[model samples]
Target: MEADPRWIETPDDGELADRLRQGGEAVRAELKKVIIGQDDVVEQVLTSLFAGGNSLIVGVPGLAKTLLIQTLSEVLDLSFNRIQFTPDLMPSDITGTDIIQEDPDTGQRKLVFMKGPLFANIVLADEINRTPPKTQSALLEAMEEKQVTIQGRTYGLSAPFFVLATQNPIELEGTYPLPEAQLDRFMFQINIDYLPEDEELEVIQRTTTVAGEPPQAILSAEAIAGFQHLVRKVPISESVARYAVQLARRTRPGRDDAPDYVRQYVGYGASVRAAQYLVLGGKARALLRGEVNVSFDDVRSLCAPVFRHRILTNFHAESERVTTDDLVKQLLDDVKPPKSGM
Candidate 1:
């Protein structure tokens, strides 16, 4: 499918970009009615949605991780399903099972496939780490391929399918750490923190005093799919593209171009996917800001989300309290943009 040509530079470019910006802002406002704070978290989630990628939200329990996914489905007017991962959960539990039943017309018994909760448009894999590796692997096919094979038959999921998986950062007992392979499927592993003092107070007041209804549907599934398509129409300059690649490459250790801190503290660097997401995310951000083309600021703002999941730190770095966030910040500070009018 081709992107909308109207998004390119034209006489009505300013007005059209403004409309797209308002559309995004409207979605955020609708979400805020139910979600209290975490505007940054909401934006990142929205960006992933518009970028057509899955998100892995990591936060302590009671941070509204499930609620956030639920609210997003409501606002987007998409089908939402939640699967609570447990130790005894099996692969069939997530990907569906085959049941033997007699045919309606014939006396012969045949096996029929029963679809699982993963068939929905938006799936919330709540406490994903609680499940064993075998059970978790069931989602790998669905997440990456957007389809599940059951009983030798594959069923394709609905369009705009997104998996919002959540994990408890504090819990370790009875939890299976996600393998690196599955982790790579996630576009962004966002860390959701506790709400601010004032935001917590507001949340209590809003939910307690009034009859807090769910958020109103701001955009239909079709509209959301359309917006995702529109994001691709946003242009990205070559310079900004090169900057994204350079930032991702600098994460590697023992490279001639590697910064001193990266070689000292970094164990592993971001993969090529990091650079791809950086540009795609930059396009979405540019569209959000009423711009047809991406700028340096757009790429810079998205550095954290793009590289956070890709960079791996060592024991020494962890002991020094250095995090992926710190590495990303250093990259942004060290990388200089090309000067204009030079």
Candidate 2:
């Protein structure tokens, strides 16, 4: 492992960047002990975490999406709660509800708030699409505001709150597609594919044999929060910032600079949130690589995940077998980054 460059032995230097690289490597190593492959998925999920954003993991069953989130929660040393979303799951069940309570002496009844599963540092919303829109909307506030409002009272969630949700891509029989508004709230729509043949064999061998020890905690919630703050402090040049904005803007079908493919396939362009995540994710990615500044490469690397869910594909694109991912690639190729800083 390459030693981090930012950790100078000095009292005044906080060494936040060095800590981020070390913590990131340690977490990845710990995750590798359990997870066989899907390194890209792991990196993207961690990028979202360090960027202080939520993720929507889409994959088929048996892809270990749930296990990935659980392992991440353990390594990060954060409180983990998994809410298995179902058709019958109600909003109150997710947010929490007040119940009638009786006093023994006074024989008086009063409503007491019962905390639900959303009050953890890391929340795994398993099968998110299995639940109805009403229940899914319950997570909106918790994800965006980092707090839940109940009965006109707001209960702040624990610091370093992250919602890593999983959804089955092949099964839509009884699933409700996430609304655009709710999907936009997620920072990345990560797609987990099948493992390579050798990696799959390794996974099977490990599973058939006796289970090994679980990954130990690597970082605390406080540390994660601090790193998230540090990520925001990482600087990006004006040229890189402009490239990120241009990439996001070109995704809109009606934009003057929109590509021909985008105009034909996309119904609407990516929102401002997409650009925000691109920059934030770039900052996190730069920090993870032990780089001092965000680069255009960092922004380009995250374009697919950041815009995959935000870009809406029209019927023409679907008929032509053109996915949003394809359109994003074309847009990136079409939009050239500025030669120098603006």
Top candidate when judged by TM-score against the true structure? 2
Residues 57-124 of candidate 1 have per-residue lDDT tens digits of 99998888998899788777788899999999999998898999997788899888888999898999
Model 2 TM-score relative to the real fold? 0.94
Give per-residue CA lDDT, model 2, range 1-342, as digits (tens).
Answer: 222324322232247778788888888999998999999999999899999999999999999999999988888778889999999999889889999999999999999999899999999999999999888888988998888888899999998899999999899899999999999999999999999999999999999988998787788777787788888988888889988999999898887878888888999889999999999999999999999888888999999999999999989988999998898888888887777753
- Pairs in clash, predicted candidate 2: 252-269
Model 2 spans with C-alpha error above 4 angstroms: 1-14, 104-107
Candidates' C-alpha lDDT:
0.84, 0.88
lDDT of 1: 0.84
**Residue 39 alpha-carbon offset, candidate 2, angstroms:** 0.8
Candidate 1 deviant stretches above 4 angstroms = 1-20
